[model samples]
Target: MKEIRQQKKQPEVIRKRILEQATILVSQKGISGVSIQNIATAVGITKGGVFHHFPNKKNLIEEMFNQIILDLDQTVEYLIKRDQTEYGKFTRAYIHSSFIHQIDGVVSAWSALSMTMITEPTFNKIWMEWLKNRLSQHAETDSHPDLELLRLAADGLWLQSITGVIDDEQCSKLEDDLLNRTYLT
Candidate 1:
């Protein structure tokens, strides 16, 4: 009965499930490796059902990228609002978002986002615009090279975790190092 109830969800709820399953599939295999059939199978839906949500693979990828950016923005906002100190908020925000997102599977869909960023104009534009805006947001740290380095720490940790170069233990330790060195003190 529970399984029947679960399978009888609305189209929109099922669509969200498809997107999440697609993201997990994308994380394991690059964009090219994920087919509509794979997403449908993961979501326990028909290929036609998947297409009902996303017209095609490119459209799915585009939606995934946008969802990633939205999630990142929310993470940053959460960290900034928590600190309320106005000092090193950007650094903490970046570190926190990167570490949490990586560990908590929020960025699973973005494992190979670089390919999208480099090959897709809209992805590149939105990413660059976000970076530029974030830089401006931390005006106080604009002249400080350490802040710049902190940004790299976030990116490096993200890549290392996403690419499976480091285990979770090492990733957590590195995340701690970035926090202790940058803001936690």
Candidate 2:
């Protein structure tokens, strides 16, 4: 029984390693630049071993996106758990979370890789759904343009950071100033 438990962990560990390596590769090279062999080589696994975890590159990309969505959900949950009763607090929390991800050792890779994935049609549905859900949650009686704008601003900041147009420190200050001006009383 113990051996079985330990064996089960091996596959999970390998899968996670593959995903992490994939993220790094995807960030360094665009999604179009990654291949199964590249991911396998990075993870120190055989190409067949990579296929054992993901049947194809497309499958691997989809799984990568799924993992990103899970990370995003965690971020949203963290934001919701904070002081969010104010009208614009949710929006501010969201921008704050974006900065957190950029600086978070565990999540920074995802944030970086996500900028690449964001342009892919395969990942569009996942992101659109998330955006719609969040907007709905904070929509009040009518749609809130201010809240949506904050969300867009956060996305812009993340993209700028990922693309090296701005560093995290600059992005943080910009986000802070945006939040300070935009947060409703």
Candidate 3:
């Protein structure tokens, strides 16, 4: 009975540690390089312990992606409360929150997972459908052509920033321009 109780508690403890370490590693390095052994070492645990909780790398990746989706959903909620217009909410939330500092490993994990999704048929379908639904929610049919152009520009800037292709200054400038076009102007 005592051994069984300890074993049950051990899995939760190991999983928490693995996730914390994995999040840091993924944010710092991106997903391609993260490994069960590496996460285990980072957490000062054994590979078997990591596997006990995750079973495989795919599960870990999925968990991380799910967390990201949850974070994005929370951000959307915050934006909805702060801004009345759909464009304003999206612009403000995307520009301000998307590029916040995270572990290099976590960022790398996200990048690798994203690349995988690009080629995987099921993931690609789901991602495209999600994007379409999200875009539809904010897209306006009667906006000026210039406003539409600006929205695309903002999206490009956000994508670049998320991929680590743009520096903070450039991202800030893009955010300011997006805010100006979407609200001030």
Candidate 4:
């Protein structure tokens, strides 16, 4: 029974490795520069193995996008729970997750994957749906104009950080400014 469980777990391990390697590759080369062959080579698996898990490159990308959204949602939820004030809990969480949060001491995958996914029409729909859902869920606490502006400013910082246009000091200051604004009446 233990051996059977190990055998079942092995495939899952490979699948996760493929996703990790794919994210690393995307961070380095952008989506257009990476392919199934590249991912398979990085993961030490065959093309067929990747197909066995993800069917096609688009499928893999979609999975990656879904994972990023899930991670962001979890982070926002955690931050919201930790916040003492209700005025801008959601917007504050959004700004904090976008700006200060890191995964495993590196920038979150959202910074890299988003730049590529943002250009895809389907991916845009996915992102919009996520934003709409989160906004509606937090309508009571985060509906103020200042909070909206803060969220938008956070988005600008997100773009700048991903593009390397903003230095760390500037980004931190802007992030703090945005977070503080979220509390305005």
| 1-185: candidate 3 lDDT, tens digit per residue | 45554444566666766876766666556566678999988888889888878879878867766665556657655765787665455555544544452444345333433544643334566556654665566566214555556656765776697667998798888778776766643
TM-score of each: 0.82, 0.81, 0.66, 0.86
CA lDDT, every model vs. true structure:
0.74, 0.72, 0.62, 0.81
**22 in model 3: Cα distance from truth in Å?**
3.2
Q: Could you give candidate 4's per-residue lDDT for residues 1-185 as a string of tens digits?
A: 35454434588889887877777666657677779999999788899999999989988877877877887899899999999999999999999998754545565576645755644656788888999999999999998887888888888898897788998888888888888888779
Over 1-185, each residue of candidate 1 has an lDDT whose tens digit, in order, gives 35454445598878778777766766666676788988888788899998998898888888877777788888888888888666577787878776665423555534645656644556788888887898787878433677678778778887887678998899888888877666532
Pick by TM-score: which candidate is best? 4
Pairs of colliding residues, candidate 4: none
lDDT of 2 by residue, 1-185 (tens): 35454434489989988887777767667688888999998788899999999999878877887786677678867776785465775676677777665322644654534745554766777777986787677676215676677778778878797778998689878888877755553
**Model 3 misplacement above 4 A:** 1-17, 23-30, 101-122, 138-152, 158-166
Residue 15 displacement (Å), model 3: 3.2
Instruction: Give the C-alpha miss distance for residue 158 in model 3, angstroms.
Output: 4.2
Checking candidate 1 for backbone clashes, the offending pairs are none
Name the lDDT of candidate 2. Answer: 0.72
Q: Which stretches of candidate 1 lie over 4 Å from their true place?
A: 1-9, 102-115, 118-122, 141-143
Q: List candidate 2 stretches off by more than 4 Å.
A: 1-9, 102-119, 141-143
